[model samples]
Target: MRLVFGLVLIAGVALAGGAVYMARDYIAQYQDQLARERQATKDALANVKSVPTVGVIVTNRAMKYGEPLVKDDVRIVNWPEDAIPEGSFVDMAILFPEDANGERFVLRAVEKDEALMKVKVTKPGQAAGLVSQIEKGMRAFAISVDVSSGVSGFLRPGDSVDVYWTGSVSREFEGGGGEITRLIQTNIELIAVDQIAGSDVTGATIARTVTVAATPEQIAALAQAQNTGQLSLALVGVQDDTVATAVEVDQRKLLNLKESAPAPAPVAEKVCTVNTRRGGEIVKTQIPCTN
Candidate 1:
């Protein structure tokens, strides 16, 4: 009987030892998993802190040109700090001041969620017009255009154009004489076409006059060119960065006619003069002479 009892007790002790070992193994695995999860969370937080951001004001809905920019029209969004655009309004106070004398107006069409930039909006209490659109140190000059000269009214504000002058040039000009077309200005920005100054113009507008933003020097050049000859606008492609060279085309060049060399002037016969004293006056006689 004593031997049977000892065997039962030893088996009971072995079972308890195995149970404890299993529980310890399970607990160790759980602790290791918890540590890994904690480390992963820390790594994720560190990555998030590496990037900087800024709050930029963007339009909540599509805004049109000349539309009033009220407080409800814009909202702040997190924008990448390094990628923030120039002239962007990041402060709400500056964009919409309480003591503002007048409301601000949109100068250009802005799409939904587009950043509200200083160049696209007018100052507080300012009206949206050619004056507001003109940049600092730039003057607004009007150029007269027709169907032939205006690119058929396909131009819109904010569009870049190359100005061509068509008129007669003196013989001293490099393009010979007669009426010729020459590219006088390249990449000139148009601010208004006729009475429409918005970039969201839908259809082709046959404009009579187009206003352009230019420096004083550019305005002077354009005024002189417009007065001296007919000014034509050639629409420049948005993606085109190539500058138009000294492009001049004459009637002869258009027809692929080579310039005929000017005829040499006939040499006058050499004259020999003889002076003779007669009374009180000197008389001169001309005689044919050799070369």
Candidate 2:
């Protein structure tokens, strides 16, 4: 009976050793897998950090038109260098100078996290007005427009339009003058309409006058056209890039009238006279000359 108990104990010891060996094998495989996953995670993070980035100044909160912008209104964020926006303020010093006497103002509405661009804000000590919006070497010309000529107030700042002139041309001009409508200018940009200059203007505004940014020569042409005839505005599509050719229409052209040729002048009849010397005064007789 003692030998039988000893053999049973030996069998139990063998089973326990086998279980420990299997557990060690399983643990070794699990540890290797965990180490591999950890290395993969580290490699991914390193690859992400390899890409270059740039620091760009962006607005921290929403900004409205003509709103003052202080240093606290913006913050620098790390942006992808390749995806950086044009005219973005990468340096805070350039955007807000230390010696500036006044703060800048927002020219247009900007949402949070939006890049602070030069076009979206006014310069230091500058006000957000028509003067700031005008381009260099360009003059702001005001055009009088009514409900029909103004596109029913669909116009907004920064919109492009074609100007038309409609009035009578005097008989002093060539081509037998009459009332005509002609396209004077195309693709002219409006900087302001009446007092509103913001491009984010909502709804239709029946403006009495609109200011346009034009070169000196263009301003002169527009001035003459406005004076000689009534000026009308036609809104141009945002995506339209085609230039309009010279267009003019008169009453004849509108009705597709065909002009007739002028008639020939009347020819004078030639007469032959025969003279008689029988008397003191010479007598002459008329006869038809042969052609």
Candidate 3:
């Protein structure tokens, strides 16, 4: 009996140890499975965030193509909550409205290849299109006479003015005669203000100055007018079609005189003769005329 009891006690102890070992193994296996599941969940979340979406606003307009998409401008719609921004630096493809014809539109940002908004191309105080008739080498005349200010130094280079000068105008008449009239150098371009405080007439203060340009003949007339009667500079608008047409007519007349008058007669060449004396007998010999 004593032997049987001892054996039974040993068997019971072995079964308890085996049960403890099994429980430990099962717990370890469960913990490992739980850790793997947590890792998989994290990976899934990262993948979901990486998926691209539509209508995402990109703020950086300077971004080029083929770059990684990043979050910028706000996302609009049709995008997953975890989706990454698409086209962080994409060239926007715009579908302009038909009524917006002739108007320029610049894309500041884009999402899913769609334009977000129009950007301002010009800056403040910047003049667009062609300059307001104020260009280099252009001629202008002073409108007001500011002799005290050296011919109105208050004026500017870009400023437009009306030049008033009086001079005796001499022109060829129809019958080989000439006629003189009071010539006035009206609207003229002011290229430079010589003898003035500064080259630019935009704003200055001087007196008794002279101006120069490509065509100073008109200014010379104005100077003559100043000597005779009164030379005045009138600030006015730019030259229009009418004034340009008159200038063109004057230029055409100066260029083509045949259109204005009849052609002159061709002059005839004179002949000469040489007299030769042969033994007191006079002989006349004709010489060929050369032009």
Candidate 4:
């Protein structure tokens, strides 16, 4: 009985030693796994920090206060996919002179009521009004003429007219030959028949005066024509084939030239003394003969 009890005690000691050995192995394996996980986490963090950051480059010399932020003007710090929120105030460091550090620019939130952008730049010496002020082409003055004047009656705004001038003039040449007659001004534009005509004139029998858009020089020329010659408006109908021409005539001077023409010269009569002779006898006689 004593021998059996000693063998049982020995077996129990061996079992406890094997159990301790297995537990130590398990503990070591768990510690190695934990070390690997820590190394992996450090490697991931280092890779994230090593990634390059993107930035924007501005080409415009001046920027508005709240202009829409472009991607090239901004640089992502740690977060690459995030976008800068609208209404953010951007500093000058982000706008002017290239090569500024990313840390110099700070974005602050702007209120909803604030303006998003500004237009502060324009041509030199010109005042900036609205976007409408910058017209595309040269502008000219437009004259309005009543459509009721002869051709004006049928004229509509935008119809091209051949302006004619009519007047009277008398002229005396070095030899004193002159006459006068009436002159006419024709073929002037019927620009705006009414103030409310569309950009391009349209419609038939426009109720308002036809208006003509012309340069300042053209206006002066038209005024001169009107003053010198009784200006008459001629409508260029859709089918009118007559080409425009300018004519000046002086009625009184023309009439006077016709009346002042010199009369024809009178012929002179000659009286002749002739000698008369008979058939058989010669006789001398003096007689007055008219030829």
Candidate 5:
């Protein structure tokens, strides 16, 4: 019995030693693989050429029209050197020049990560108000409107509309007057609502007056039309670029009057006159003439 117990103990010790050796070998193999992978990554990185870059000022968050451009609203990011945008600001001094009196406003709405350009912002000390938004050779004209005529207050700045005149026309002769509704202006750009020029307004606005940018000729026509009749505005889609030719509708046309066909032009009856053979005295008599 003593011999058998000693033999079993020797076998168990040998088996345990073999298992330990195998575990150590497996761990060392994994460690060597990790070291080799790290070396390969270093070699790959060393061969890549670094791209040249420059600091560019970009909007940190979205900005709406009429909002002032502040230091906190923008930040500098490293942009590729070759693709730097025009009018980009590289430093704080250039962005907010000391002579500007710290008054820089956003001319248009800017989105996140958008680079700031001089054209996108207003001039130094110039407010992003309605006056600044007017286009060259255009005047801002205000017209009265309500919820019914104002597109249910869905109108905002930068939206285009079609103006219509609806009223009866005064005529000098009886039955010459008629009530008509016609499109006076098409694709007119709205520049303001009440006094607000920014479309970032919180609630729906049924502006009592809408200011539109128009040429002098348009302004003159609109002034006369507004006084002659009630002006109604039709909202136009942003993508609607085509101006309708002549959209005029009277009460008769709107009701689709299938009036009688125009009466045929009247034909005059042919009459032949025969001269009497009295010397100096001449008398004429009508006789039936055949075609």
Candidate 6:
């Protein structure tokens, strides 16, 4: 029994030693493979060159029009130095001179990571108001609006609209004066609803007045038309840039009334006068006139 136990112990020891040797060899192979992978990765990285970049300021969050800008609303990212955009700001002081605080506003909606440009933001310390939204060389003009005329108060800032003038065409024309509604402007962009300049798209409240961006000529024309007649707005879609044809409606046209023939022209009248003279005194007699 002792001899058999000794032989069994020897066999168990040899099996244990063999298992340990195999384990060590497996670990060594794994280490060698890992080292080779590490060197290969390093070589690949060395061959790949990275372009140098410069820091640029951009909006940290998506911003809406007329919203005040703050330090938290912006961030800096490494931009390709060769691809820097014009008017991009690289330093905080340049974008917010004198520590403008929250006085600066975005004139238009800016997405996250969009480059902060001087043209996209209002002047330092200036609020994004109706004037900022107004394009250069353009003026703002407000006209009274109501439920029927203002698309049931669905009109919002930044919406395009068509303006119409409704009143009598001529007060002293034949057959009395005719009422007419004519389109005065087309594709006019509304800058504000009441006093708010930002886009208030919610139709929760009705706006009493809507302001529109207009040129000097348009302003003058609208000013005169507003006084001469009742001006109304027809809301147009933002994507709709279709040019509207001249649209005019009168009572005759609305009811499909036949146009009356023009009145006959009047003839000029002729008159003759005879003069009788005695010495230096003279007497004149008038004759009847005929057409």
Provide the global lDDT of candidate 5 against the true structure: 0.89
Worst 10 residues of 2 by lDDT: 43-52
Top-scoring candidate (TM-score): 2
* TM-score of model 1 vs. true structure: 0.70
TM-score of 2: 0.77
TM agreement with the true structure for every prediction? 0.70, 0.77, 0.25, 0.32, 0.70, 0.61
Which 10-residue window in model 3 sums to the lowest lDDT?
Answer: 120-129
Write candidate 1's Cα lDDT for 73-186 as tens digits: 999999999999999999999998989999999998999999999989999999998888877889899999989999998999999999988889898967467889888888
Please, what are the lDDT tens digits per residue for candidate 3 over residues 76-150?
444453554433322333322344333332211133434333221111222222222234554544433565423
Q: Which digits, one per residue and each the tens of the lDDT, describe model 6 over residues 1-291? A: 999999999999999999999999999999999999999999999999899999999988888887888889998999999999999999988777785545788876788889999877898777776666777899988898887888887777778999999988676776447788999999888888888776635555577898889999999999999899998888888678689999988898899999789999998767678899989999888988555
lDDT of 2: 0.93
Candidate 5 deviant stretches above 4 angstroms: 1-8, 28-52, 59-73, 80-88, 107-114, 169-177, 241-243, 261-291
Best model per lDDT: 2
Which lDDT tens digits does candidate 2 get at residues 62-153?
Answer: 98889999999999999999999999999999998999989899998899999999999999999998899988999999999999999999
Comparison by TM-score, 3 against 5, better one = 5
Residue 289 of model 3, lDDT score: 68
Put down candidate 5 lDDT per residue, 1-291, tens digits, no spaces: 999999999999999999999999999999999999999999999999999999999999999887888889999999999999988888878888888865899977889999998877887788887888887999999999999999999898888999999988778766446898888999999989898887677778778999999999999999999998899999999777776889878777889976689999999977899999788898999988876
Q: Model-by-model lDDT, in order? A: 0.92, 0.93, 0.45, 0.46, 0.89, 0.85
